[model samples]
Target: MRRGTGRRAMAYAAVVVGLALSGCSSGGGESADESAAPTVTQTVTETASPTETSTSPTTQTPSGSITPTAGAPAVDGPVVAQDQLSSPSGNIWCSLEYGIECEVKESSYQPLPKPADCRLDWADNQFRVDRSTGARGICRGDVTFTEQPPELTYGTTSVVGDRACQSTETAMTCWDTGSGHGFRVSRDDYQLF
Candidate 1:
């Protein structure tokens, strides 16, 4: 009987010591429950009133940036077409321009080595082949081409008139009816038709 009682006492003492050690083992003296407490986060946003007219310059955001220029005139005419041009050295040039803006790109490319010109006559709503040489092509009006970013997955096909565009997570392709004059926008490089 004495030996059994001594063993029982020793077991009880061992349990008590184990409990005490566990209580102190928590780091920074924080309880286990306190350490596992959930954290809360708050986000705040500000909006301007309709009556407010901000004179401050435009600011850029993390996703994208657009700065308003003082002397830049507002773009006129609807966007009719888009084109992506690629070079033999694997350089990509993409442009999404309105009918009037296409003329600007065409005249601007006159001095450049690459054929970056996309001339459009907004008055006639026609795509011009070569403004300097007076070549004419198709006519498109108010047809918008939304560019698909490389990160987006390409699913299904979006066709417009004689054009078809397909997008993948890493690549996008827009082509004419015959796949003759088109381009592919990819994460690695742009392929022109």
Candidate 2:
């Protein structure tokens, strides 16, 4: 699905826009990858306590334990999507092939440690989740910010299958279509709800 150049980001860097992010970069397409993700120990607790924590998810995933509390939670709206995406500033990027996987080139918040079972790279700046699931860091050897996919214009969003990602001036917000729950990431911090 990595077959194109990135487009320019729009002016509304703070607004939340949404569209289907196919690989074509014309706001079309769906997830084409289905390899089972590794189990991640990060858990999604329904409790109001953001202090909750756990052990793993299905490989670089967020299903085992963790509460998302980065900045004040703010999920404005949906953004268009492609198989992959770049934030307008090029500081963040994402891939929706398997739910939504995103990473920030730079951030300020301290993230959870790598799940014990994760053998790949585990970082606080790396985020991953399935549609309808809570957000967590990803344990991966690859990155989504390769600039191979189209850029998700500021204020615009990209969605493939059950996932959607929105690029804004402050942070990139993405969520699972079924649960409406997702996470937000930026150069300074991240939040999951």
Candidate 3:
């Protein structure tokens, strides 16, 4: 019995020593200094999302850089009938003086071959429309179109009698509205249609 008690006392001493050296992970073992220490945490939130409001989309017209528009062009001023008009760049001049006609101060197209019967500075610079000669070039010593007419803003159409002329960013076009015959002229080329 004495030998058994001696063995038990040695085992109990070993358990006490182990318990003192081992880590106690529970809150019960945390000291006041460790428990009082603060832990830092960071959180982020976002606000302000982008939003946009839009309506009708625009369409591009044949005239370079021109956006198609609907309804009649806003009339900022009176539109004179049988009046003259120039392109935005003033490179072209057109008139409703006698007929729907236009002329480029400089052009690349072949000038009308001067006829032996005709005496004038043969000019391919001018193009005009008439019922008989749908559209044709002129031989002129000097005439209307190159004479610098009033400015006609793009997207605006001027009508006088059966003739109409419209200036655009890229070209100037004139026609006999009733017959649908016309000419379109730009700096380098012209079309009589």
Candidate 4:
């Protein structure tokens, strides 16, 4: 019976590791690496089960301590919504509404801490919240800005190490294929294409 329990625990661990990997980035070929970067549609599913107390006499010794087998929560972490991402730049922006907070350099924007009103809209062009290169970070998904220009569409994914440009249309969204670093859609014209 103990052996069976251990096998079940191992199976659960494997599933979790698999899920985490599927969301990670790849280097040369297709592989998973979580530290890489996260995309928009990345969904995390958690199932909550009611705590069950075993009535087995032998399992419950006189020590009065209930021993958990495995596959349990080791630490407590806050449950962040999919729209809200905690980037290395120290700013949290709503991927749905307000534009991403990033650094603007040489027509490129990298994630960085900034005020809520990062995008200064104009009739023709949209200025982004300026960030210092010293505080560089990754951009995740490539989303479209239906408002164009002054609206500065967000959601473009550059390669893990390479700096790519965000397109004004669908060119800005990143695929879940696992490109480790997240990126920002910059208004700059410098293209690496």
Candidate 5:
């Protein structure tokens, strides 16, 4: 009878150990499945606020058009009208009231010969000033004037001016008040002043 009781107790302990091991194994399997399961992830994007965007100033064009925060230099002087260009030398006149003048010259100092065929022709804001060597013609564009002359590129040359000029979508114009020397180009109709 005593041997039989010991065998029964040993059997019960074995059964308990087997159950505990099975439970642990099952728990590990569940944990592995949870780890392998797909997880939901989210992403977010942010945009700048108006106040943050407005840190830079706005630029206004000669045509009364406003470009928002382009960071372009502001025009220091008033804009001259297209029809107002005039020169004291009667060669080219952009605007006398605006103090903008253009003249044809042989060199930096020498004026173009009399009857200098210095004339301005334009299509919209785009213009070509025809003149003798060193002669410049002044004209205005549809865009607003800036302190810095707007970039007026012609062929391989990048036109720059000492005086004020404005840039537009179609074209740019400069007063060329300093040297009075026009731009040199192969074409008879080229942007100079």
Candidate 6:
């Protein structure tokens, strides 16, 4: 009986030692759950976002940098004759008068009316005097094109009455008689294109 009590005491001591060793882990440190305990937790929330957009207004002009519109005409004549261009065929007259140089271009190359200096023929949208001593055609002076960069000036005279737009760099003084004849005069550097 005494021997049996001795063996039981030894077994109890071994169990205590085993429990102590288990408390101290293999790395010889306390468990992670005990060391890391949450102290404070913060949550972030976002509100409505602002809208970003451009506030500039749009105002569009013609192609050229500076385009000056012709003021309201004092006389009563259509600047652009839509009615005249309705048919594929119509008569349009352009007369240019520069000092000591004057000419007229018509759709048809008819004989010059009495008192007129000469009669010209229209060829390839251009009318040229068959025989003339001076430099007088329909096109004369400086010209600027809205679609092009470099401006041009013409010394020769040739008729360009059928073009959609007639432009000249030179200044022109124009007056419409309401009749078939429209008067255009250029002085010195003045030109009709």
Candidate achieving the largest lDDT: 3
The lDDT of model 3 is 0.61
Cα lDDT over the full model 2: 0.59
Which model, 3 or 5, shows the larger lDDT?
3
The 10 consecutive residues of candidate 3 with the worst lDDT sum are: 39-48
lDDT by residue (tens digit), candidate 1, 6-104: 555655565556445555777655446543222110110111111346577984321121122231112122212223322222222222222111111
Candidate 2 per-residue lDDT, tens place, 103-185, comes to 77767677577789999887667677754465667777865554456688777656566576767788888777556677788
Worst 10 residues of 6 by lDDT: 39-48
lDDT of 5 by residue, 1-193 (tens): 5334555565556555644555466576342334322221111011111123345687544434312222222344444333333222222223223333332221223222323343533222222332222333323333222222222222111122233334333223343333442332221233443
Residue-level lDDT tens digits of model 3 in 19-119: 44332534476433442222110110111111334556975332232222221122333344537888889888887777766778877766667678668
C-alpha local distance difference test of each model: 0.32, 0.59, 0.61, 0.29, 0.32, 0.27
Model 4 C-alpha RMSD vs. true structure (Å) is: 27.5
RMSD of each: 21.8, 28.4, 24.9, 27.5, 22.4, 27.1
Which portions of model 2 miss their true places by more than 4 Å? 1-81, 141-148
Q: What's model 4's lDDT at 35?
A: 45
* Clashes by residue pair, model 3: none
Error of 4 at 156 (Å): 17
Model 3, stretches more than 4 Å misplaced? 1-82, 145-147
| Regions more than 4 Å wrong, model 5 | 1-63, 66-74, 88-91, 94-106, 109-193
C-alpha lDDT (0 to 100) for residue 175 of candidate 2: 75
Cα lDDT tens digits, model 4, 71-150, are 11111222111322222222212132243333222334432344355353211112222221211333333333322222
